[model samples]
Target: MPPTATPESSFSETAVFGDPVAQQLLPLTNGRFAIQTVHGFAIYDEADLMTVAQSIPVEPPGWPNSTLSASAEHLVWRDKNGRLFVQRLADEATLDEAILLEVPGNPNGWDHPSFHLSPQGNFGWLFDGEAYSDEPPVVTLYRLQDGAELVQFRGGLPQFTSDEAFFVRDTAEGLLIYDTTRLTEPLYTVPRDEEISIWDIDLTADWLQITKYLRAEKRPFVELRDVATGELLHTHVMADDETRVTPSPDGQSLAVTFKQDDGADSPTVVAAGVRLYTVSGELRHEFLAPQISPVPIPSACAGVWTSRRSDPVYSLVSVDFAPDGRSLNVTYNDYVATPVTHLYATDSGEKLAEFTGHESLFVANGRSFISLSTDGLVQQWDTATPDATPQTIARYGTPITDLALSNNGELAALVNETGAELRRTADGELIQQYAGATAVTFDPDDQTIVLGFVDGRIQWRSLADDSLLSEMSDYAAPIRRLAYWPNQPEPTVLALAENDCRVTRWQLATGRQLEPLHTILTFDEYGDVIQMSIDDFTLSPTGNLLAGRSWFMYGFGVWDLSNDSNILTELEDQPLGVRDLAFSADGRLLATGEAWPLGGWVGPERGGLRLWQIDEDNVSLRWSTELDQFVGAVAFSNNSSLLAVGYSSGDVTLVNTHLEQFVGRLETVSGVTGLAFAADGRLLAATTRDGLTHIWQTGSP
Candidate 1:
């Protein structure tokens, strides 16, 4: 099937940073510039002032980059709130005035706004259109004015699914929405005839760009398009192992970065690099840095940091770019107790600052340190100097079982050796402590804390005074996990009990059981109940379903409680010794991790993930991939398109569900024990058996 052609803006050629070649130098406007870093957006004002736009927390399984674009009057970005944010980038502006326009019907995936900005300062968003049935592809157009939405135009584009995104452009006829999903269908009236799969699309002022790779090809090619109409855009075929692409703010240049590969699926064998091109599709310059060998820290390595203080002896792994595009800030490779690397001038590759002895720093309004010491302390540091001096903000000297941070950064709840503690973020002060607590979380209001204990009890405590408000009980064994449905008003708790492999729901403030306890205790060959997933379990975001594994059966099952006759459908052909399960936020997909013996041998050898899409009565097994070592956990991105698999071998792989292809892979700490996504969908936190947490920056989409 070929993608259909639509009338809208599109992008094709892209430039990327860290492309294993060398740092690139792009001429900036007024000698000041902006760069899209790994996580957030960065800008350097004309005065050489550097500022980070926003630090969105990564959502687990995984969340894609928030749709971001800048116009003459505002910079628009999607936050974890599942809403659109329009911030006035004009100097001296506050986010308070950054209007947040809610999407009608509360669309899922926090689907970023897809619109076009007119030179006259007018912008339009493609809203959820009216689906009257048997429609082709249609999207409603809503123009932005005075922080509100106005009906601009409608029914000029092809019909598309709500999950699909599109771009708009103004032409002689009117506004048009060009859908890229048509790429999966047959090309009828479309322009270009390349049969490549697209990873993403970007639109420039004069041209539309697409990042695509042909079937069985090593690297993706860049295709360009005309802005006012669906015209053939130029194409740039790339070499294998290409990594990143960036278009200049003025839409005149494209920077690309790629790494050389010795073999397939091998760690890139070169230094970070770059390439540049003009809007006319002409190669301008190529830069290559001296390749620095990766120094493997002791397998005792605890974590990686971008702003940490240590002896200047170890390598670090950090990527920060100067706003002027004249320099790049990089930390050495992540190593045991490494220090923060320095910012090097892109032109001369000269060091600007050497942050020694400081723990890794997370920069916000000001610099803050972050450390994972052996003593169970999670600390923050200043990035300016090597003063390894640390400030102990929070310490969990005991073994930790489970933890959760609220949607807002106001609370931290965790089950440690001393039990569950609800800590206030203001001063890292212990707000409340509960004994034998298995999991803790903050309610939607951020005023109440729900603590689930091993004794099959759940308590809701007021955050202000630590007073117990309500308690729900009636479980068979120790509760292993607790989760709440998103945006629900009442306090409904989903409890997972390991002893009997049960999933139960209880309503707070009312001693009522919302539903009967569901379990994986299905009858075996002899009609005897077999307990499964006594070790771990995961609940869908809506709390209407639960996914877990059976230890001996080596399979994962989904328990659906929305119907009269609740059913637990076990995924077919799952390997034995299944460990964990994760569902997308929408509960449309399920990802499972399992460990099994290879070559029909005895001990656990191979494992990976199996993904399933939920239909009405039957489930569609989408794809399955095998791994080298045991898979500890699996998570789906908020969009349900990508799955993050954490392996016991300290490796993480991101896979696209639709294409069933690998997106990227990275190394983590020791065997992963727990994996969580932050509310912002920007950072993924993985807790390993080594008692360390590794946070990875999911670069901008």
Candidate 2:
């Protein structure tokens, strides 16, 4: 039997009290930009960063260049399927009728196709080609008013002049100039040596600036040529260390980045600084990279910059001029450290602003900016208010593997690539960080935490001073989950090893392992007996009952932990498999949630939420309900009055556990990863796949 798809729910929405992720930011006009998220993209005015001029509920292409292209009056973008769209930014009456055109090649291909809008917003161009291919790239020019193709040809790189009257293509033979009115042939060509590689080209009203590197001399130089006559105006040879050169929008000045060795034993060559130069080769200013420690040094040596034996060095990533060309943006990073972006005054050589932890920066204007971090967080900054917080326009959060909440609900623990982080639940402020931790859980008293590492080591640490209370290493695989045993006489915890697929109980005070519980078994395809492991488990509040789902068989079983006896094992009706389980506060009700199997393995049942009554010696299903998406997490209120089921569809459905009635639904922008109810049952915290955490106020729901 095939799985039945559930219909969407129509319940009154519950407001999210706390949301921690912001939309991503992309530069557009001089003082405007776009904010994108999983939902859609919205254009914002930078004056106050609040006015939304236009918004479209369409997902942008995966490639950054194809995401959005804006001119003074219009916006252009391509969808994943190579469909190009043009929208007017100002006129509300023309907003509904956006011009659309189907581009020829695969925009989502490995070649990374890009779209560019003309300065006047009257023309658009699309470039498509493979990076390593010998064939020339395909270029198509389109008239934006009606989505009409103006011309199509094979070109190297296209540069449009400011007036939009002419464009130039840098080809293997030379630079070919094309007139907007006459599309038949090039007006003239500026010949160049075959051995010289053109790094970048910028076209101005009267000058064509080309940055080229000579293969024989191992050097780079800039050439200024007359745009109309194809005659060389000036040739400026740069220093050998100067690797990259970028011309300002007006083509009057240039920004150059260089690298040098720092006299180390191994000859550590790093990007030393940036230099501002006139078109005629006169150096205007030089700004050097700051020498600083990547991490915090001792307090005693805080102000003493020379105390550290070795300072961090950075390699240049990119350099760009502001839209107005009065300032420059330089980005660099030590491969192993956080990247930094610095804005400097082009004329004075004075550092205007410095932003750390960003891989790239875009200047909308002299006062407005957008930055992208390595981890996918996009921020917008206003230079006028340097002391104020930057706006979080977008975030691509690191995936959270596991999550745990403190008993008092005041703190939340999460595990990711950087180990465990303790965050305050109220406002999501990071309180403490623990490195190399794989799993974490809080004690009943909420004063200490137990952490499991990848090396199978477990440690109990105090929350106040972060002192290690006890530790033990008894396993040989990564610790997957850590949970405290409820209603225990002494402090006890259960640690599950990922590869070992076995749970080990340990005494927190003595660092001793306790006796093993019941062994889980299943039958193979050939009907032979095989030992199985638990994928997920939950212990009842009284510590007398335990429920777990098998890793291989997809079945789940209930056992009496005190007597070490299996009470029941159910393998029916569960087509996919159980993902998570939770026991009610009174230990009388058990809830199980299921997730779809990996690798697109579909079954008759996509999985849902099931409520069961736990008797003295048996378990019986009280009620079950199917959801639109497979259940990802489940939690019961402290008073056992409500059950909150989080689904992969980013919807959380609350139900009256005793009445068996639907309550309300909460929504997020991504799939829910984990869910927990506060100790007082007044708040619910839900973690999502987007690395964001949302807190909802539970008001009688």
Candidate 3:
């Protein structure tokens, strides 16, 4: 046995749960799984469970149709308007891979989209599903390399070869194979043995392996003929009553796993010894179903409690070779999808690891096999090259309701039923727990975390030891925002009152409480204080100026810190209440952004971000950039050169502050909850409403 290979000493993350209603395992590639939900498609990395590589929204352009197919790189969908969409996933800050093309057929009534793209991304095949059943199927081929539409012909079951593509179909004359690369040309026709059905046939690159189904003859027989000339190479007579032939793409090898009746009272799927043969019909190797099987295969989340029968029942789901031709992989499922996967040496037929309960076995270009268990455990086994013990990557539990990443990007706090857990983001290692925390934030130094509970209590814990540093009595309400001055010493914390008014200040070290502070207050004709809804407010980097909504003022403000004076500023002119605010690293530029309430959508023209220049004499509006969609979050890059704006459209727009222009945009699978710039300012992290934290790289300004 070889030691396991690891990219790190240990790594773990939570993957997002698929929509139980209409969840599907999208094609896996390079350790990434694209999950198709009812609303859209999401790509998840093996680690970092909810991390979305890219998400394709199914709304205006594409909806009311079915998901054609999806993989890590490509997503194909059809809309009601007879439009087929092909989206290429990307990390770039732009939507460059979205392609909307009108498919030339019935739009609304098709049962499925018959489209397939090769793994190498060089060619594509599509057939109109509606026309296929009603009339002759019209197949169209496209050259992916140049985006050129090839010839159209009538065929089914298209398979790609080395340099040519071929399709098989049943005709009056036996099974006919046509080279799609050359339209209107027939490659070969199988020689019939007394009019056998041509509907099911297997065509490899160099061999057309056709199994003759004779009802009188209990077991079917297969013939190997040249794919191009129809010349008979050899014949293989299956030993059992039933068999399935799986041929490799190269056409040089074939695997036949058999099932036969043992003349018992109850039939069992046993004696399924798989045989491997070369194109010349010589037996290369043989593998028997192992008798010493685990009670419940690892392929299933839970095992069935059926009492063991006297005779063991076994079956093979699939068999294929490793890309390098050194090893082979075989999946043995009892009856349903749960399977026990056996990896064996191709030349010697020696058993390796027996993986249980593995479904959706995907082999990547790296020679590593990725298995997803029914229990949602994602494991990556790199039998290709091993060095250490293999490890389980993640369990991919239900999506976290809320999440927060430390400003230093070192810790990610996930919300659960009990409370919140702070885990090391680097390796998903749990570091501390904040029980019953409703709101959380880290101090400027990132060493101490301040947690607010539902009962209005505030707690501080040291990150190094997970020890209680300080605990204070309840506030009027659960804390909303915890603001700290960048350069202030002895660390004073300002929190929004439970009712969303008045800022209460406290000392963290001694848990000493202080008097509440108010900047501006309005009075009615009765001389009573007026109440207002305050959504956002932020303290300046120097802890002097403030931009928020209070009782009388709702926009930008510079409060008198020493006396708590309610002096109004230019912000009094703005009518819309501020939704979010941020101060630049230099403290000279204050940015405020807001999104209008449109229920759940980031409706167009509903919100935008405004940049303000703060100076000693007066505060003036620099430029207000209009956002075409609903704003989700806004944050200024540390250098104040760029601002990251997240939207309800599941996209983040990067605007250059100095130029006041849209630089680029990044797409997400779900709406954003908050946006924060890493301390280094090179990376921007955005947390989605679905509890996924996406960290994006924004290069130098």
Q: What is the lDDT of candidate 1?
A: 0.51
Candidate 2 deviation (Cα RMSD): 12.3
What TM-score quantifies how close candidate 1 is to the native fold? 0.41
- 227-318: candidate 3 lDDT, tens digit per residue: 77778887777665437776766666777776655776867655666788775668888777655343321121122112133236455557
lDDT of 3 at 508: 86
C-alpha lDDT values of all predictions: 0.51, 0.70, 0.58
Q: Candidate 1 or 3, higher TM-score?
A: 3
Ranking of predictions according to TM-score: 2, 3, 1
TM-score of each: 0.41, 0.56, 0.45
Q: What is candidate 2's lDDT per residue for 1-701, written digit by digit as tens?
A: 11222322333323332223333566665577776545456677766654567665544422222345555355555553445555555555454565455444343234556677776567787777775578888998887767788888887556777777888987877888888788788889877787888777877777787888899988888888877777888787989788777778777787788888777885665448788888888999987776644433323233222211244577654788877888888876664445788888777887878888765678876666777664556677786775468887655555466778787778888876547888887777888888878899888879999999967799999999889999989865567778889777789998766534345789999988897554353435457545465656777767777777765426577777777554455443443467788999998998888765434563322556788888876678889776545687889988998887877656677777877776667766556778888777767888876566777656533
Q: For every model in order, what is the number of clashing pairs? A: 69, 3, 14
- State in Å the error of residue 507, model 3: 53
User: Can you give the lDDT of residue 183 in candidate 2?
Assistant: 72
Measured by lDDT, the strongest candidate is 2
Q: Give me the runs in candidate 2 sitting further than 4 Å from their true place.
A: 1-24, 46-48, 59-66, 72-96, 103-108, 111-114, 128-135, 162-165, 204-206, 262-267, 292-311, 358-701
Per-model C-alpha RMSD: 19.7, 12.3, 19.0
Please tell me which predicted candidate would have the highest TM-score against the true structure.
2
